[model samples]
Target: MGIITGVIGHWGWEVEDYLLDVWEAHRTPIILATSSILICVWLYLYFSEEREGLVALPRQYTVETKRTSPFQLSNPLPTTKPKVVGEKATTVGPKRIRGEIPRQTTQKESPKRDGLEIQVLVFYSSLTGKTEKAVKDLVEVSQEEINGAGTGTCRFPDAQILDLSEIDYDEYFINPPKREDGKAVDYFYLLLLPSYNIDTINDTFLEHLKETHNDFRIDSAPLSNLVGYSVFGFGDREGWPTEEDGYGFQAKEVDRWMAKLTGRKRAFPLGLGDLKMDGKARLLEWSSGLIDVLRMFAQTGVLGDGVRGSGDADESDGEYASDEEEDTETSIEGNEKPTKNKGSIDDVEDLGKMVAPSEKAPLAIDFTTYGKSKPVNIQTPQAKEMVPKTSPTYAALTKQGYSIIGSHSGVKICRWTKSALRGRGSCYKYSFYGINSHQCMESTPSLSCSNKCVFCWRHGTNPVGTIWRWQVDPPDLIFSGIKEAHYKKIKMMRGVPGVRAERFQEAMRIRHCALSLVGEPIFYPHINEFVGMLHAERISTFLVCNAQHPDQLAALKPITQLYVSIDAADKESLRRIDRPLHRDFWERFQRCLEILREKRFKQRTVFRLTLVKGFNIDEAVKGYADLVDKALPCFVEIKGVTYCGTSTSSSAGLTMANVPFYAEIQEFVEALNHELNSRGLEYGIAAEHAHSCCALLASARFKKNGKWHTRIDYDRFFDLWEERGPDGDWTPEDYMGEETPEWATWGNGGFDPRDTRVDRKGRKIEV
Candidate 1:
């Protein structure tokens, strides 16, 4: 080893020098060749690893083993652990690392079942707890009725009652709830809603339904999954005496919304009840009807014949059609049979031999007469009854509280009559005229009308015709029938709470007749005779016409007052507002105005202008003033349109927004009065009924000394009518009553002082 060390020491310097020279010369080439070789080795290693199915570990998963000590014992654990059997393995991949592991699909498959079990959900909204109590009673009654229905293919479980104020709208309204146990189940919704003028949960629920229907992201009818639905509403009749006055308004709105949401699956017509009077009875009746409908659905799975399913909104409880008549008409149209000859041919002698026997002869034409002569002994077609008992029109009118009289006439107890009986107040007629509301009989001789006004509270249920073509009932029969019906309806109100004993007794005897119940009173062929019949009984007559029938308006009748409905001030506006059926409606209206001008001295002429906000209120002052100047009526009654919660109105784009507020009405009235006065028209704002949103403008002729004399003297009117026949000359001043009441005058509110005003909850409202 020493000899080798001495030799290496001697050659070390020479070997180091030789190596340094070789390194300096080949440095560049050596670096290039090494890089190339390293690259080729790396490519070959990568390809070999790929072929062996090896993958580079991600940075996050790269394990760095730190050796605490080089001498530390080698870990005994294997790098790859064996998977345990029956254990849910953790997902380990790009998807898992990116947090995108697939989730179970939300799309659920409907379970197939043998039969449908109907689950009835009774929903209610109450403000004063009255509806809550009613709902409890209804649920109990419904449960009993369903239990009594016996077992069948469709089984009904216990009914569920839900308070609308507490329920989540999205859970039920957006789509029907899914059964957790996966059974074929159908749901029926029954809503009991109490209307309140003030804010309530009902408004919020209604808004949700509207938004859901209008939402673009959802189907327009999301609740179409529901089998059926119905609604019953409770309201205070004393505060809101009519549907047009917001009685049961919320319930109606709910029914309408449900109809839309359920694709017109209104299983039953809406039932409205007066909370203080027939609320329970109506609820029971509605429930009974609903139980019948449920049975029908279970047995047939169809809403019976004549029942509107997925169609128009139901406006009445009953619907009927004359199948026999329809079949006959269809047969006649299909057969095309030749009409029988009315008379013998005049030229029969010329073709005596050629003519066959009379019985076997073909329909012969009379050459001499040709088409110039009318057919002799040709029986005229029989006139049809205006409102048949089995007709839809009759059912609709009865449902709306009208008692039909004769075939063509009807009599109804006005809301004002009920209010007056309950000492709530009277209609605007009572404020302008001295007619006792409870003692007034509101009747119409003809139920057929000429116009379908947009503000018609009847919801297009009343029949419309351009002419009187129905069978005419005798005037005497109509008069008596109307009186009996009126008295009967009034007597039915005897058990109603808050009815004054004296007022109830006074209502038994009719002191006046209001011919403005529904239709154009002048349309009755025997209107004059009918008025005479009322006058004979000392009942003052206030006949209102649509002003479309000029001949009837001009023909004759002197009564307490004559009203011509001036719905619009211009022709185009009239067409839009009145929707008159007559082709020459404007001419007829102008002629009626001229007739009124001519009859101003003979009868108490009035122009009743129903102001619909957007349709006729804007820029209509001067036009109305011109009409007044042309007619020179004794008084002009201006009233805001009453909003009827009807599909017809909704389709016409009319809503609560179109309803003018009392303040807005006052502004319009004031503006109209200014316009009239500026045109030298001696008309003044004589009185106002703020409660009814009505204002009266009287002519100077009604002004006695310094006070306006607008109120009519019923006794004096009858006296004048009896002393001088209807055709006799008479003036409006002849039967003028005392000066207008102080409380009824302009700016005094026009509410009777004796009656107390109450809020919707029956709390006395201090004026």
Candidate 2:
């Protein structure tokens, strides 16, 4: 039956059987047969496209005749004439010789906005307006030059720029005033980025846009075009590789978004711009280029046309004379947020200045202050020199997107907060391991060591060697970098689209701790001062030091958490794994252990064994247990080395085969508990990831008699043994390896396996 309909040229349903009877019996002429065959062929082709996809092909008519590019070679440059040149002139009589005749004639009026262009909407994120300054500088050079023959004043339309922090996309971009619910004014200057991202198109950007424009569909036609209109990002090549490593990736976001608009290839890929925190010159150059792009439709007459409706043509053609006179009066301002009260406050600075009078009900909030950068170091220990909460650095970091890691508002280490990761590290729906969980402290810090261990995931590396290499950066730059890191991730997630649950929150938690970046941090001479600065902020410090600097470790006060990176059990393996710069590395490590034994130290100390598969796990663990026993640390964390950073050393930590290796070590540790028990010590299981990593915190006092030694004053013991010289060096008072303490021996004849080395004859140590 369906075939019969097809033979009659009907559509929609498919039929397996043929329409026999009448058609077969009739047998037709050549013309009729040909016509019938054509009908069948046409029907089959109809369903093919529907079955395949909805991708629409270009229309047949006028599509080809249209210009191939938005900007054509013949297009005129934007014109900013008389006003740009700051010229002023009064017309003289045409027939000056006949003086009286000229006074009777009147001059023609100029337009109110003669040389203005299309309104551009620029969405920017700036730290101390470096990015904004870049834009302004571009605007300056790109403005048109004027000659003496020019008529009246030409104009530069006051461009409308919005900081993404303040505006609501739904209110302005998606829905216009008439839409009450529909049609937003399409402003093209939407550039989004000024910081860090694991990727170019991030979850936070998508989420913010989504939440801000709740009703809009990401895949829809109009919304994507408006949001995708124009884009740019700023980032560095220091961290993990992402799509936005440079101009190439940023351009791709622009291209990808543009693809949804034109259904064609995008000509411009993202342009990567890097600032190794260099000077202002590069910024000036880049800004000028961006401004040039903005002036595209400027000379095309969008603003010139808008000016035409104004009655006074002369006034419309903004004169340079008028510009100077109206400089303070007619400066146009915009409202990024769609608040109902339009004229209540003039501008952003006005909003801030109202702080004295305390503007009530509706107030303009400033997120710009948050977008500053601050460089933290362990060197240059001048207590007063460090930035304070009220300091420009603190204000700058807090105002933008940056949040300090710890509880205190004043601490300066890598300005981070929980929101740093809205996707990858954090699962937005759940609040685990993000901003609030980060803990740090202010104390005269102590601890130093070698080895940028493979397992470490810190954002920077101190790269060991010296302190005071560079002068301290002003408060704003460091904090701005810190603050912008959060929003940058948010923007990235937004571009890529979907994110795992809770990944956002988890990422935010680790914001301030970029454990691996450049150098080894322990070499900073003023580490004590730096730590003390944080302590004043009510933050507790976790000083993770390499054992290479035990002398520096000795010259200090107690911190919140101290770590000694012990990568091996003995000297030879230590060199292979830690790659220390010292001649006698093992002895240096031993000295670190000695510092841990100091009695006055009240901080919780730790020995972190970076257990790689084959490198030094066996030696390090047993030796670490020995160090743990002698060091009398508060905790011992035996973890597998994480393979990252510049080391081509072996990926022993990351390979799948290491699973059994890690498990075997755990078994070894559990078995060692027996030895710990003999010596009245204890141990626990191992872990893999941050949360998976468990530990054993040691007891303050140990047992001597069959009963117990209830109070051995751990602090007093540390104090008397660790004596300080006038020059700030440490000398152990009664600390001697030759004299074994009572606790070194268990009830049995043998000593604890961890504290006693094979070479020693029943001696040399005890925690």
Candidate 3:
């Protein structure tokens, strides 16, 4: 300022230093950032790149194909989806492996396993009383073999039929035939016979056929896949030559000892006949010509590549060969196309031949109503001279065609039932019921049954019959009353001959039915509302109670599927396979398994255990593990009881028909299913068909993350079945192929329904 004073005074102090340099150039950056003066030297350092973990790439892993049945799957499906690098050449036109493709493809079909599904059983056996009008015309030609035209089941997909007097066949070989929440059985169609004593054998059919000829592993390793058959012996002509229907000379010496135990070959027979008096019209024209040639050899397989099946016991059923075109004019210069095609009765001794009789035509009767130009209801010589003899439509039903009416053919006459086991002369195959329903859907219609199983099949006496026995007939009036009592039993059978008036009116026509027939039919308080009105018509029941009705199955109402029938593990083998009839039947059979575990439906709950070979196949694994611990059930089946009718008249009065003691009680129930999966608890023999039955199921897994696997939800058992709708809507997308239960990551991971990467006995290992 002094220098300024000197200057103007030197220019008035340069105008106050240019007005404080414009106020310190906007206040000197706020006092030089508040004191660049108070600060000095200092520096800090650090840096980063990481380039996303240095350029990644590489993954790969595979192997899939979990899909299951419904005609089996897989064309492209090995299961994968990261497929992003090459699909749009302007919309699906190019790329057969263009870019991100390492590629290798080959599996357009044939990993193999699925092509199996065909079925048909058709059995028949009657114990005189002229085989009850040929068991009402072979239950109307075995319900016209699942009907659809040309007795060959039209397109034939899964056929069936059975009725050796409503069989017990020792619990269908040991297992299959449960229900009531023990879920076992897997569809059927039987009418087979030869479970022995030929029906009236005596002493309860021979004490249930000497307990089924002293149990010889039921009869041959769970009946080795049962395959198809067509035997039809009934009796008389000194029962097929006597000493009890002279088993066609011991089945032609047990078919040369079963060709030394199955290396194949040997089958064909249709000779013997008679369930009583003219052999029920030659077994209804030989069951309408063996259900028209085993329903075309049970859906094609007339044994191709040069078809040649016929192992003669002396031929004579009309000398075999004729795939039919009005009984073949002898073609075979080239194979004529026409495709095709259960158990026991002491296993067919070289079986074969039985064709002739009702050869083809007639079989169609699925019945929603197929009166098909109706006619043959017949009987009127003045209405058969005015119906009488036991009046309820009689005069011995006036040579059939029964006219004394318009109503009342419901047929229920009753008595001759109370069995306790006694026959083993051999015949045994009976699984019919389907005329309208009753058995699993709670079969009351023929009145209530409370326990009278001396090794039952049906026709029990005492408590008397008849309850709802009507509205269900149509498979052609049970096949026009069994093709007019088997065309008056093929004019009294004898020397055979007669039948092909186009296969003897296809013995009228009927289809599958098997209410487990015999006693304790739940005890009929309208038995579970007639099993929900016979599963609303799709029909597939298999009921078999006898826990003396566990208070009528806890006052009825909860039976779409459930089965109790334990047959002894305590209370003295339940009185040797239910000889019960009250005394509080084992505290009402453990209170009907606590009312089948507090009832609920949608099918699934089973326990069946019949395994009676010499009274309880050696402690049947602590009697089926205390009936699967009071019914945690979903199946247990283990069946094996058979010796035949009245139980071969109750073991031919104890002289026992001898069958290697029912094959050592079916080889100790297959070591009680491997001692119930080595005591841990998992099972699955599921329908072996029979040597005396099996069927297990339930690995009961699915615990969640911690691990364990296959308690088999199998997409909920392939979308569950058998419902008539009481409530079981079933959803999981109805299963088949990969409909997504998805989450199956499992490859080398860990989850564990017991960690079974393979091992259903197929065994593998990775853990």
lDDT (10s digit) by residue, model 1, range 176-245? 8878997657788989888888887988998998898778677676776576787888889899865556
> Among these predicted structures, which one has the highest lDDT?
1
Error at 461, model 1, angstroms = 3.1
Worst 10 residues of 1 by lDDT: 325-334
Candidate 3 ranges beyond 4 A from true positions: 1-268, 275-280, 290-596, 600-604, 608-725, 728-767
| Overall local distance difference test of candidate 3 | 0.36
Score candidate 2 by lDDT: 0.37
The most accurate candidate by TM-score is 1
lDDT of 2 at 752: 23
Better model by TM-score: candidate 1 vs candidate 2: 1
Residue-level lDDT of model 3, residues 47-131, one tens digit each, is 1222322222233322232222111122332222222233311212322211111111111222332233334444444453454
Could you tell me the lDDT of residue 566 within candidate 3?
A: 79
lDDT of all the models against the reference?
Answer: 0.71, 0.37, 0.36
Model 2 segments beyond 4 Å from truth?
Answer: 1-220, 225-518, 599-601, 619-621, 645-647, 650-662, 682-767
Q: Which sequence of candidate numbers ranks them by lDDT, best first?
A: 1, 2, 3
Native-referenced Cα lDDT, model 1: 0.71
Off by over 4 Å in 1: 1-379
- Using lDDT as the yardstick, the better of models 1 and 3 is 1
Relative to the unseen true structure, what is the C-alpha lDDT of residue 751 in candidate 1, on a scale of 0 to 100? 93
